[model samples]
Target: MRLVVFDVDGTLVDSQHHIIRAMTAGFAAAGLEPPPRAEILGIVGLSLPVAVAQLLPMADLATQARVVEAYRVSYMQARGERAAPLYPGALDCLDRLSARDDLLLAVATGKSRRGLDAVIAAHGLQGRFVSLQTADGHPSKPHPSMLWQALADAGCEARAALMVGDTSFDIQMARAAGMPGYGVTWGYHPAEALDAAGAALIAEDFHHLTRAIEDWAS
Candidate 1:
């Protein structure tokens, strides 16, 4: 079987608005100024804890914890009203991949279980994925645990798997796990960064993404 692992936030869905809004609220709760919009966007694919730490390196542990909690609550509230929607063409791409018996879809995201579940249910994507590796169960991105788990869960070897994501972390993880990395242009990271991070292929658009995966499967 061929394994295709996807990243959650920017790769599948456009959640930057919710991410920034919640992070801004997190800073507010901690009595600190919100990070610049550019900085916040730059760290899109990172796990919450790592993102928080990188954004607020000077913050004490207590303050960081509060920020995390505040962001979680804010995200939950915002998500309840209207969640960050999947990108245009995402459903079609997923559908095409899902219909292929040779391909086994899986999710390797930095989102915690609660957050991942919310997005999955909201998008009616629960049945689309065969496995999900959440932040709670493994080390965050740039680590191979999630990808390794995905391979194990899908009962596929690393050489038969492909990692699709929007950031360097995803590319690095794929490299560490001996799998090919496919980068998406619509996601957070720039094409240059993905190339530098050792991405084997970069999809210029959704159609290209689908085509690339199909070609790989064949």
Candidate 2:
């Protein structure tokens, strides 16, 4: 079966505001300033610790940990206030892709297992993904660990799988895993960056992305 692995934050859901707000809280809790909006979005696909470290390279481990904890708490609280919504055509695209018997859907995200669970619960996406690889056990994006686990879980080869995401880290990870990465324009990263990262196809919308996946499969 062909596998389609997706990134959650920017790829499927529009969580920019949620992320920015929680990041503000996290940095505040650490007595530091949050990075710029672009900087925050730039690190969207990386694991929390890794992302935090990038944002605060000079900070001590304790400070980074505190930031991570605060970000988690604030994010969860924000979730209770308003769950992140999927992109305009996200659900429709999922429905179409998941309906195929020969295709399997999976998620490879920097989000914790708990966070991923919240997303699934909120979106009524139970049993929607054959593989759910999260940051809890794996190294962050660009490490290839998450995609490796996902491929193993679905009994699919790397060449038969496609990674769909919105960042350079995702493309980098897919490259390391021996698969092609499809970049989404609406996500955090720009098309130029995705191209530089060696994305096989950078799509503007889910319709074109879906069609591109089909073409690749065919």
Candidate 3:
């Protein structure tokens, strides 16, 4: 079976607005100024602690932990206000991929398991993925552990798997796990950055993403 792994935040859904808002609130809660939106977006795929640390390089451990919690709280509040929507064509792509018997879908995301489950449920995406890996269970992106575990769970070789994501960290993780990475253009990172991070293919839209995956599997 061919296993296809996806990143959640930027790759599947457009949560940047929530992310930035929550991040700004979190920093304010900690009595600090928020990082620029571009800086925050750049760290979208890393686990919360790592992302916070990157955003506040000079922060003490206590401050970083506080920011993390504050960010979570702010994010939860934002979710209550409005659900983030899936990217255009994301659902259609998932439906098409799910129809293929020879393919297994999985998720490798920086989100906690609970967060992932919430998104899946919100979108009625039940049973769409065979394996799910989250930051709560593994190290952050670019580490390869999540992808490796996903391949193991799917009983698929790395060579038979493709990683789809929007960040350089995701591309690096796929490379480390011996899989070709497919970058999505509409995500957090730029196409040039993805190209430099070694994306084997880049998809500008959901149609292109679906075709690229099908072609790779074929």
What is residue 71's positional error in candidate 2, in angstroms?
Answer: 0.7
The sequence of per-residue lDDT tens digits that candidate 2 reaches over residues 1-218 is 89999999999999999999989999999998888999999999899999999999999999999999999999999999989999998998899889888899999999989999989999998877999999999999899999999999999999899999999999999999999999999999999999999999999999999899888877
Query: Per-residue lDDT of 1-218 in model 3, one digit per residue for the tens?
Result: 99999999999999999999989988998999898889999999999999999998988999998899999998988887888899999999999999999999999999999889889988999999989999998999999999999999999999899999999999999999999999999999999999999999999999999998998889
Better of 1 and 3 by lDDT: 3
- Weakest ten-residue segment in model 1 by summed lDDT: 38-47
lDDT of 3 at 79: 80
* Top candidate (lDDT): 3
lDDT at position 54, candidate 2: 96
Tally clashing residue pairs in candidate 1. Answer: 0
* Stretches > 4 Å off in candidate 1: none
Work out how many backbone clashes candidate 3 has: 0
**TM-scores, in order shown?**
0.98, 0.98, 0.99
Clashing pairs in 1: none
Q: lDDT by residue for model 1 over 1-218, one digit each (tens)?
A: 89999998889999999988999999999999998987887877778888899898988899999999999999999999898999988999999999998999999998998989999999999798889998898887889999999898899999999999999999999999999999988988899999999999999888999999999999
Worst 10 residues of 3 by lDDT: 74-83
- Sorted by TM-score, highest first, which candidate order results? 3, 2, 1
Q: Give stretches of model 2 more than 4 Å off.
A: none
